[model samples]
Structures are given as C-alpha cells and as structure tokens.
Target: MEISGIGSFLRNRRFGNYLEASFGVNFASPSKVAVKEEVEKKIQSVAFVEDDGIGAVLISWVRIVVCFVTMMFTTFIWALIMLVLFPWPYQRIRQGNIYGHLTGRLLMWILGNPIKIEGSECADEKVIYICNHASPIDIFLIMWLTPTGTVGVAKKEIIWYPLFGQLYFLANHLRIDRSNPSAAIQSMKEAAHTILKNNLSLIIFPEGTRSKSGRLLPFKKGFVHVALQTRRPIVPVVFTGTHRAWRKGSLHVRPAPLNVKYLPPIRTDDWTADKIEDYVKMVHDVYVKNLPESQRPMH
Candidate 1:
C-alpha cells in the first residue's frame, strides 16, 4: 500500500471505531452500534471463567508437568539436530523456528484453550510487531500466529531459562540487557539489522515486562527507536485472554478463550527520533482504547 494510504487509514477515526465495535465494545460513533451488538452476542456465546480451587490447582500442576516434559523432550531432540546443523547457522535457525512453532502449538493444544485469531491476513507483510505483554505464553502465541521467519526481542535474563532459553538462542532471537543502557542500545541496533538482513519480522513487547494487573503498562521507548531505525512499519498486535489463561506468577493454566488481533501497520517512513513519545502514545492508545474495559490499565 502507498504511504499516503497508510497515513489516511491511520488518521481515519471511523476505522478505529470499527475496530472497537468488532471487539464487542461500545464506540462513541453512532454508526457502529449494529456491529457492536453483533460482536457482543458472539462474545456472550463464549463463556469466560475465573476459577481457583483444589481441582484447578491439581489441573494446573498436571499441565505444568506435561508441558515441561514435552518441552524438555522436544528441546533435547532439537538440540541434537542443531548440533548436526551447527555448521549451517541459517538452516539451524530455520529449524529452530519450526521447532519452536510446533512445540508452542502442541502446548496450547494440551492446555485445552480455544484460540481465536483475528487479522491473520496481516501476516503477509513483514513488519515490526509491537504487542502487549501479559503472560509468558505471549511469545508462543505470536509464534503460532505469525509466519516462520518471525523472531522475538527478549530480555537478557531469558537466556538463562532452562530448555526454553537454549531454544530461544538457537532460534536466533535477539536478547538485550535491560540493566545496561549501552548494551540495550546495541541490542536495538542489532535487532534492526537482523530484521533487514534476514528479511524476518521482529516482535517486541514495548511494555518491556508483563502486566501484573492484567492492564496495559506504559511502553518503553526502545521499540520506538527500533521501528524508526529499521524504517519498518509497526504492526500493533493485541493478545487478550492470555493472562486469564496463564496469569503472571501462577503455575496453573486455565482453559480460557485466547484472542489475538493484528491491527493495521503504521508507516514509519516519516517518523523521527523526536516524535518517539508521540508514536509510542499513538500505539499505546490504540491498545488501551480497543481492549475491553476490564483488560485496560487502571487510571
């Protein structure tokens, strides 16, 4: 699409209203009432539950054991394959993405959560993806929805996570040290370069960390710089219900509806370093306004 078209679309309030209506939320615009009602009926058909009990606790532990075993077995097998293909880094990384994707899907299936993905048609374009962080499963959710060449930008600490860390490294996902300003800057540069060099879409949680309150957190500015530096359009993705499925600091996984929406990409051709805050706020508002009120950040 032309840059002008993108600009016009982004500025179009009606489209934003339409998105809100699609999520079963009331929009200030009167024209969206019909759409809003339709979405509400659909949403009502799918039950949303929040349970914490003895059975829930037992189920959660079983899921953890099963998922852990599955991950370890799969990661070890992938590790062996990686060793054999170590001489061919590109092929190794490709295999790692495939392995990660398959393993993630398996885990989701085992968890028995019904996933409803929207705007998957946006996957055709390669762009920088900025998503809300709410659970550890956010990475897997994105991997399952996006194309094969997508990589994630994670914190440096994730490199020490057991089997998952090894797989993350083998997948060639970029990791940065949040504590070291200089290192973090370098990682951002590397992320931009990696996207251009590998022709892969990069996923970054601008929030920097998961939300403990299930509300959107203030975004970090590093991703803004990454988008401007790479000159790639920014695709705002929202993963609702993941926190309900697996809340932060919880070991149990609930069988909840998982929603993934890929919103339109905003062109970054005219973006500059000086407008970083404005850019961040624009995207942040898109998430805050679109999400259900219960999922939005508390004022």
Candidate 2:
C-alpha cells in the first residue's frame, strides 16, 4: 500500500506536469507517509477532475468549438479547392491537403500543447512513418507534420468523426477496413502500390487503435507488411503525454507537454519474409525504448 518513491520518480516524468502536484520532488528527506498521501491525492484528482474549474471547462468547450467550426469550413474549403483543381495534374491536388494540416495546427495551438518534434527532416524521404496511437488528436498532430507526397493510412470508421473524417477522405488518404482480414490485406497491397507509383511517403498507426491506458499496445503487422513489400525505410514515432491531454471518452482537452520523436529510420532492404515475426517485434521494441515507462507495455 506504500507507493513511496513514485512521487520523486514521477516528478521527473511529464505526467507529473499534467497533475501539477509535487509532494517529495527533489526533497532531501521527505516523509514516506506524506509522499504516499500526496500520490493517492494526485491519482484521485486525475480520475475525478480533468480540469480546474468552470472557467477551464468553458475554455475546453471553446477550443473544441473553434476547432470543429474551423474544421467544418476547412473541410468544405478543401473540397471546393480540390474540386476546382480536379482537371489539373493529380499531384497538385495531392499537395493541396496541407490546408487540412493547418487546421491541425490550429487545434494544437488552441489546446496549448506545443510539439517537440525530433528528426522531422526525415519526413522528406519516401518512407513509411509508423507512429503509436494514443488519442484522436494524433490525427491532427501528424497532419501538422505530414508533408507533400505523403499520404496517411487510417481506419474506415473515421468517416463518422464529424467533418474531420470527411476532410480526411477528401484529402485522398487511404482507408483500411480492419474488420475484414481480406479487405485489410487488399488495402495494404493497394497502399504499397500507391506509395511506389506516386513516390509518396506513408504514415500509419501500426497499433491501429488509441491506447486508453496510455500504454503501447501489441502492434499489428500491416505496417511491417507494407515496409517489406515496398522496401521503404520505417521511421518509428513515439508520442508522450497525449493520453492525459485528451483521453478516450473525455470531452475536454487538457493541455499537456507533448513530445514526438522521429527515431532513426529502419531500413528494410535486409529484411526477409521469413522473419516477419522478428521484424514486427524489432520495430515494436523501438517504440518501447523511446517511450516513457508510464506508456510502455506492462510485460
């Protein structure tokens, strides 16, 4: 029942910043009972209160409203823009999706989560960028970073998510049906061909669904299959502290410090089909090491 050192240990972590309470942080000789009491207090607060007060709740609703309003118009804007340019070369339309990414930037700024992206320069190459999923804001965060000739892979259910989903489809991004294995495999194959034909980079959440508990889930193998089929380098992306910002069912978006690091790319030239299992685990470990202990898998 005594969780003593967690107070000091978690203080060094970002989630501590989210809760904004420090009992034994950097203390010379702190009482064990005090630390235990404060830890329990913080956990209870995290579970019960997502925001500070009515003002904070109002701000959260304002942020949600502004972003959705902007996204609704933004979706129509992209639709009209792409429709007008339909007769032009397809590349022109492909590159025009940056408008949608701008909406993502708006969300990030209003939510007050500043991004610290490492090795983003790697997005320039024709490769597969595989990121861990933890929040719906993940879509917007990546959109803000996604570059020209880079198409993203998302699930088919995205269509139900207000105008955000419609904007995603209008942007010419690929959607995979995870419910049907045959459909998912066919979708990946088509994704591979699209990458090669258009010379585009692919961004996918290999974990498939956001982790409600903030831990890395067992990675699905579709990304590995695409990497092997296309021979594109895989850039492992790890996002920290997003789960606490906007949780699965939470209505309000609590701002938190977020870091997205693009680890060094993994080349697939030497990878063989026979070692698919090894390949999946290898890439999975990359994310585990880059993530905070709070977000890593329990096993």
State, as a TM-score between 0 and 1, how close model 1 is to the true structure. Answer: 0.82
Q: If scored against the real structure, what TM-score would every candidate get?
A: 0.82, 0.79
> Over the stretch 1-299, how does candidate 1's per-residue lDDT look in tens digits?
44323323332333344335435455554765575465546655677677789898898889889988988998999888888887876566566666766677667656766555567667567788889988877867665455556678899889799988877887677888778778788889888887788787788889988898778999988888788878888888998888888889989888777788988888898998888889989889999977988789888
Residues 163-220 of candidate 2: C-alpha lDDT, one tens digit per residue:
6676566667788888887889888999898888778789898988889888999998
- Once fitted onto the true fold, the runs of candidate 2 whose alpha carbons sit more than 4 angstroms away are 1-51, 87-89
Q: Against the true structure, whose lDDT is highest?
A: 1
